[model samples]
Target chain A: MTYCVGMMLEKGLVFMSDTRTNAGLDNISTFQKMKIWEQPGQGVITLMSAGNLATTQAVVSILDERTKAHDERDPSILAVPSMFQAARLIAKTLKDVIANHAQVGQRADSAFNATLILGGQIAGGPPRLFLIYPEGNFIEAGADTPFFQIGEMMYGRPILVRAYEPGLSFEEAMRLLLVSFDSTIKANLTVGLPLDFHFYETDSLEQGKTGRISADDPYFLAISQGWGEALKSALDQQPTFEF
Target chain B: MTYCVGMMLEKGLVFMSDTRTNAGLDNISTFQKMKIWEQPGQGVITLMSAGNLATTQAVVSILDERTKAHDERDPSILAVPSMFQAARLIAKTLKDVIANHAQVGQRADSAFNATLILGGQIAGGPPRLFLIYPEGNFIEAGADTPFFQIGEMMYGRPILVRAYEPGLSFEEAMRLLLVSFDSTIKANLTVGLPLDFHFYETDSLEQGKTGRISADDPYFLAISQGWGEALKSALDQQPTFEF
Candidate 1:
């Protein structure tokens, strides 16, 4: 299982994904789930995937291979004119990969499905974020729904719902995501560190910033411990129930 | 859907349950999920259920009727001599009810299955808590696993895992539970207001303090709002990530 969240805020886009993947309790491994396609001043796109490891890797391989092909026969995600078209390309690739795998004796209902979060900016357009489903359909983040979460989402969702603001700064958004991810890691073993984080500023048309947070990262440790203590202190301050 | 939690603490036991039940988003109603059977000085058993509303209601009705029946030929839950025995009685009754309903043409896999949290104390024995499955088998909460939650549990679980301590006072436990429930309610539409809470002191062997917290209740409102602000404040206080 994986846990990933993408937010579309006034400042830009924030993306985070856990690296833990497991076939079973005893077969756990660390694998990066975030992929970036950059065209310097032209455009920048980031994709984070969750679901079957094999399927996600296959989708990424197909997209990466297309970008390096000598022939201009196929359009790569990096060459897509807009973020919408980039998302469409990734969705189509994902569906074709899953369908091809299913046709070769594997049941489609098996765990070979993958969902993705695609977000970035094209030089002339504003930033955008989308959640691409395994069925190849996708939905863009709108004013009413400013964020999208996939895989092991429920454990970390309350904080996002309660604290998310439309105009948060990049720093504040990262802090919020850290707290949310910490809560999930504490409550569930399937989702572990290190975590991948990306920050994209609207219209920059360049790879903004990216980093990895591991189990012993000082800032993450502080947030995890600080949030727990703060919650207990808050509970202590609340009025007790009267019988 | 429902959300219910039962915890066995050093001081005693704490049980909290939401009263919302819904077959679909359009069809929502309030229904109590907590049931108590107390012989005052002899024993006190509390049952909180989640899952199929009809199955839970049927199980409760059967137990209630047996306690009221004057005939000695049928053994009632009230006659159970120990907390373990009481749990067995409830589990057996629950399995029987589900089986009986299945025999009437409904698929066994239908929503007619219920999961329950049973906690209480009997004179001359230590307090106990059990999670009864639909198949009539149950597992008691122990030192390693001190609490049990059923139905829409993920949203509220992280807080419980972070803050729960066996030595917490009854008031502290209730506060913890309120924060957990508030998290659930904020994140999910299926778990709603008018929560039922019960507290049983060890060796008291009597019905404990119980109450309901509705949507407009002042203390509940305070907890709900205060927790959100507290979380945001905590996030602000955390050290910002350096790129």
Candidate 2:
């Protein structure tokens, strides 16, 4: 039960992912779901995954291994020519990992499935965001749909749909994500703290800024409590229904 | 798809259901999902359903037919002794309907499945609310969980969880439900107008106030717009994160 969201705003890109993972209620653990690949002036790519941990980890391991390979023939995420190509590489790696595990005769519906949010900037192109499916296919965010959310998405979606604006500054975007994530964590136990966040400026072609938000973080606490109180106040302000 | 929510508050019980029904994106229609049975001075029972429209309609039809029968020996929801018994009657009828449909070799997971939120009051007892599953089993809403939602629930759930209070006035409870439904309608295509709302006052031993809210209703519009604006304003007020 992960909740990861990525936005392709007019200014740049914003990505956030929760760290809690669980096979069952009793076997809960924390695991990082965000991976970053940067080439400074060349480009920066951020991948946030949700679903089976084993499958996602395997896909990341394969990509990392290729990036470190001495042979120039080996394809790597860093070697991709564009954001689109980087999405394709991650999608392909994910599909291959799932297929390899399925070869052991596991059912097609086996839990070896994972979905990813890939967003970043390439040197010559605008920042782009994509939602990669388990089947190795992906869809890019467009003007009509400026964001993509995977895993435990519904609880936090209304807020995003109502408030998201194309020209929002990176600070405002991160604040929006925090409110969204706060709603999710309060409603669902499977999604919890130690959240990973990354912001990529359009032409910076670098990692931009990144950080982790834990449960005790003052800013996170302020947002959670503030949002709740604000909602109650809002409800009080609304006109009552007449019968 | 449907979205129906029922809450048990110290003042009484609140029930709301959207009227939209759809087979797919191309085939959509409006169908009532709330049914009420009242023997003034005796009891009042409200049933809100979600899932296979056919199955739910059949369950209601069967219960209605039995209650109209002139024979005294025939079992009927009207004859149930307590709210618990009423819940059992609805559950049993629901299970029988699903089983009859399955005998024709339809898959168990067929769209014949339905879920319901049943709540009301009978003479000499406090109000009660139950969530009835397709299998005919049901669970009552307790102190810890005073509400039940079926079909497309997640989007509207967080607000209900955070703002619900056992002692809220009937007006406050209805207002809370409107906000919750407003969120659901904005986020989901399957749940829409007009909404059916019913309030059952404790020990009233009769159906309380009931009304229908259509898409253009002034009150509904106000809540829908007010909630969106309030949420955006709240987002603006939150402290931004530092990276």
Candidate 3:
């Protein structure tokens, strides 16, 4: 299980993904699920995935190889003309990876399915975010739906729906994401720190600030504890039922 | 889909369930998922169910008929020796309903599966809570886990984990539950108003208080709107991230 979210805000795009991966309840490990591909001053692409680890890793490795080997047969994500094209390329890679795995062992196709959130900007296009399905189709986030979440999303979604504002600054956005992640991590064992995040300043066409939040990060700890007390206080303020 | 929660508190027990039932996104209707049997001063039993509506309604009907007809073959839930026996009786009835359906028409057994939360007190026994599964087995909630939620639980669970207290007054407990339900209703279409609630006071050996909170109920409306504002204010109080 995993939890990844990408928000398209006025300042830019913010992405966060948990590292924990598990094959079963008893078998778990930490694996990076966020990948950033950037050609400074050209294009920057960020992909966060949640699903079968092997399928996601294979898709990422294939995308990385294409970028590094300068292979004309397969264009790099950084070479895509628009964020839409990059999403299409990633969706195709994800579907192909799942298909190849299914054929090898003749396993259920669902076993190798993966979902991804892709957000980025190319030199000539505006910043965009998409939720790519395992079937090679995708949907973009726009004004009405300004964010995308993949993997173990329910526990953290209500807060995002209520607190997210289009004009929030990067700092406020990160604070929101951490609060969202904190709610998820506390409720499910499958998602945890250290969380990885990247910020893409709108129309920059370059890599933006990025950081990893370890388990003991003071800010994360404060948010986790503070949110609980805050929620309690919030509840206290509501009118109690008279029965 | 549904959302039903039963919390065991120091004062006694509190139960809440949403009334929305859906065959698909387009086919939805209001169906009460809560049943109460109270032999005032003898015993009081409350059952909240989530899952296949047909299976749950069948179980409730069967239980109801047995109590009404005074059938020798089927005992009334009110006649159970203890809260544990009541849970066992409910679990077995649930399992039989699913099995009977599966044998008649070769559909997946999971299609008929239903989960239930049973909480109450008998004249000689203390108030207790059980989470009954479709497999004819159930587990009781204790100090470590004081509540049970079935169906569409994730969206509403974090607040319960953070706000529930054993010493809470019935009013405060109901307040906590409304917040939990409001979060779920906003995040999911499958769970909605009107909400049903029941309270059993410890050692009362009888039904406590029960009510229905319709969508337009002023208190329900206040909590729903007030909670969002409180949450935003809480978020504002948190220190912002520095990048």
Taken in order, the candidates have interface RMSDs of: 1.4, 1.2, 0.7
Please provide, for model 2 over B1-243, each residue's C-alpha lDDT reduced to its tens digit, 9 standing for 90 to 100: 999999988889999999999999989999999999999998899999999998999999999888887884367887888899999989999999998998887576667999999999888778999999998999999998889999999999989988999999888888899899989988899999999999888988888999998889998888888888888887787777666
On a 0 to 1 TM-score scale, where does candidate 3 land against the true structure?
0.98
The CAPRI quality class of candidate 1 comes to medium
Per-residue alpha-carbon lDDT of candidate 2 for residues A126-220, written as tens digits (9 for 90 to 100) = 78899999999999999999999999999999999999999999889988998899999998999999999988888988887898999999988
At residue B17, what lDDT does model 2 achieve?
97
Best by TM-score: 3
Per residue, candidate 1 scores C-alpha lDDT tens digits across A111-181 of 78999999999877789999999899999999999999999999999999989998998888888898889
Off by over 4 Å in 2: A108-110, B108-110
Off by over 4 Å in 1: A108-110, B108-110
Put down candidate 3 lDDT per residue, B89-191, tens digits, no spaces: 8898999999999899677849999999999999888899999999999999999999999999999999999998989999999999999999999999999
Tens-place lDDT digits, model 1, residues B2-109: 899999999999999999999899999999999988988888889999999889999999899888878842668767878899898899999999988888974666
Better of 1 and 3 by lDDT: 3
What lDDT does model 1 reach?
0.90
Complex DockQ per candidate: 0.73, 0.79, 0.90
Query: What is candidate 3's CAPRI-style docking category based on DockQ?
Result: high
Candidate 3 regions exceeding 4 Å error are A71-74, B71-74
